[model samples]
Target: MNPILEIQQLTHTYSAGTPFQRTAVEGVDLSVMPGECVGIIGHTGSGKSTLIQHFNGLLKPTSGHVLVDGRDIWAKGSDIRAVRFRVGLVFQYPEYQLFEETVAQDIAFGPKNMGLAADEVARRVRDASAVVGLDESLLSQSPFALSGGQKRRAAIAGVMAMEPDVLVLDEPSAGLDPRGRQEMMAMLGRYRQQRGATVILVSHSMEEIAANVDRVIVMNQSKVFMDGAPREVFSHVAELEAVGLDVPQSARIAALLRDRGLAVGEDVYTVAALARRLLALKGGGGVC
Candidate 1:
């Protein structure tokens, strides 16, 4: 089956034909299968943001093609606006974009943009708000009056209301606290499961991506440095570190134990997984 999204030889240059011109993404070939969750990790200016922008026609590639479901997104008169509805993008600090009079209106913005019926829009708004855990009463309150985290949830709901087939989020939990971040991720996971949508998340946090994504793509020097499952990608610790990324904490701890002669599994990444492996090493007893 064809992938949900495909990018071939994609390149993007800022300030083209000028002395200060610099390529933010170069010759990047990537694909996301239907219903797959992919995570992208890179340091600032590594081009991750630039790459995702191409997925939904937010930014046209300078010299390559971005295909959505086997069709070039830039095909003549290609309803790029419809593409945006099909591939919802949640930008970093999305809350800052909320300008509606109330949370319900904010959440309905995307669906309304899609020209949905009034009843359908209302239903979508409530469903999306529930996904983000926004209370029913809060829907009537002005978005500007909500707290930072609440505002963020409202904005995210705005995108969720579109029910996009491919959800692309750029640092969805960037400024949230630990609990808030965890909650946001859980909500996103639930949404992905319910819709069976393809998810592409861009984050600087190795731990978050390691715990959630089915595959991880590492970006470095404006190109794809590595692409594989979490275990496969994290196995190359040295290269990742060189690219300003790190393996998950549990992976590092497991490595330490292996270095000290413990038979810990090198593939362990999650804390619970590592703990289970270590306990098994102790013959079902407590940590040795």
Candidate 2:
């Protein structure tokens, strides 16, 4: 399948041509296939955020190009506004973007900006609210009146209402509690399953990436370090650790068990999967 988004030989520099000039990303090539979920991982300052900002024209590349649906996003006279509508971006701590007086208005913000008719905007608001599990009753209340998790959902609903072909989230669950994080992930999964939208997530948490993504892309020193299936990437624990990124907890524990002479499993990143293997080892009379 053809990719929905492509980044070719992309490079970006922040604070250019001054004493603060610094290269943020360099020579990165990335592609996201239709209906695929790709997780991006990197250490602090690895340029993950800077790299994704180029996808929808939020940040134009210093060199190279970003193509969406086979067209250069930065092409002369290209409708960047339309490209943004097609590629929704949920920034880290999206709740900070919610500014409307009420939840309904907050969720309606995107469709309203698109100049969609009121009835169409209402329909979209309802559809997005369902995806994010926001209640219709709460729509009448001020967005700021909601709890932090609810505020986050409201912010997400704002973006989801656009029904973008591609959804990019930068640490969407950054500050949520464990239950909230699980709920957010479940919502994202359901959103993908229902809409078949291409999703890209930038997260530093190895466990979150392992559990949620079909493919993993690792970044180090502003370059693509590795790109593969979750199991394949997790198997290279030492290399990841060397880059200041850890393998998933289950993978670490599995490695420890293997070193102790138990044939548990390799690249085991999910708790449930590792639990099953550990239980089998115990039941089979193997020493723990």
Candidate 3:
């Protein structure tokens, strides 16, 4: 299968030709296939945000290229604005960017920018609002009147209204309570399933990545430190820790149990999987 998004040795240097010039991302290469959900995790200032900005032409590469569907997005005369509609990006604290007077207007902003018809924009607003769990009653209210979580939902609905083939979220669940985080992720999952969209999630939470993504990409020092399935990547707990990254809690606990002479596997990164492993060690006895 063809990759929906591809990065070829991409590099981005900030403030080029100045004394403060520094490379945020250097010689990084990666790909995302259609309908796949991938997570990117890194320490602060590890270039995760810089790297993703290239996906939708938000930041032009200093060298190399970013390709969307076999075509370089930076090719001469290519329409960069069209790429933004194909790859929807929701930044951290996106609620701060919501400026429309009404929730519905905010959600319709992207679709309207794409020059969609009135009927089509209205349909997108309704569909995106429902996907994000926004109520019709709130459509007429100002975005600032909503709670933090509701504002976030409205902001995300704005991007979803564009019906992008690839949705990229950076720290999407930041600052939310556990329930709110779960609800937000559930909404994204539903959106991906319904649209068959490829999802790229950039987060610092190992548990969130382990539970939701098909693949994980660990970044360090402006490079791809590790890239693999969650189980595959988490199995290298020592390497991850060496680079100041955390593994999931279940994986850490399983490692501790194994150190104490238990037979738990290093690949146990989920709560249910760890529980089952312990149960099997107890000869399949039921736990109260």
Candidate 4:
């Protein structure tokens, strides 16, 4: 099967050709398969944000191409708006974007814009609401009146209502408490599984990426630093630290334990995984 999203030699320069010009992303190449959950992690100014904007035509490449289903999004006559619908992006703090009078209206915004039938739009609103775990009773209430977590989910429901083939979230869990963050991540998992959507998650949290994504892409200094399964990428702890990115706490501890000749696995990245490995060692009398 063809990749649902592909980027080739992509570059984006801000304030181009001026004294204050800066290249945010440079010569990056990557492809995301349909139905895949991919995580992108990097330090601030590392270009991960710039790279994701190109996924849905929000930011056109300064050079090279972003292809959705084998077609360049920037090609002449390409329907950029349609591309946006196909690749739904939820910006950081999406709750701040909510503005409709009611939660239902807010959730229905995208489908309505897509010119879907009113009945279809309503159905989508309901479905998206359920996916995000918003109560039906909340539909008639003002979006502004909802709790912080509810507002965030409602805003996400707005994007999901579009039924995008690819869901790209930039810091979707930012600013939430740990429980709220876990709930948001679980909601994302439900949407991806239910819709079979390709997901691109951009986050600064190694724990979130390690626990949630099937594949990890590391960005550093406007370049693709490492791309592999979570275990493979997080395995290079020193390299990640050198570029000013943190490895998950579990991964760091596991690495230290391994250095001391413990039997914890090489691929431990999550707290649960590390706990299991250590427990197994203890059960076997390998740890006193």
Residue 145, model 4: lDDT of: 98
User: What TM-score does prediction 2 earn?
Assistant: 0.96
Candidate 4 per-residue C-alpha lDDT over 1-288 given as tens digits, one digit per residue, 9 for 90 to 100: 999999999989999989999999999999999999999998899998889989999897899999999999999999999999999999989999999999999999999999999999999999999999999999999999999999999999999999999999999999999999999999999999999999999998999999999999999999999999999988888999998889999999999998898877768999999989888888898954
Alpha-carbon deviation at 32 in model 4, angstroms: 0.3
Error of 4 at 5 (Å): 0.1
Question: Which stretches of candidate 4 lie above 4 Å from their native place?
Answer: none
lDDT of the candidates, in the order given = 0.91, 0.91, 0.94, 0.94
Q: What TM-score fits each model? A: 0.97, 0.96, 0.97, 0.98
Clash list (residue pairs), candidate 2: none
**What's the distance in Å from true for residue 51, model 3?**
0.6
List candidate 1 stretches off by more than 4 Å. Answer: 284-287
- Model 1: weakest 10-residue lDDT segment is 278-287
**Which pairs of residues have clashing backbones in candidate 1?**
none
User: In model 3, where do residues sit more than 4 Å from their true spots?
Assistant: 285-288
Model 4 weakest 10-residue run by lDDT: 279-288
**What TM-score does structure 1 among the candidates reach?**
0.97
Best by TM-score: 4
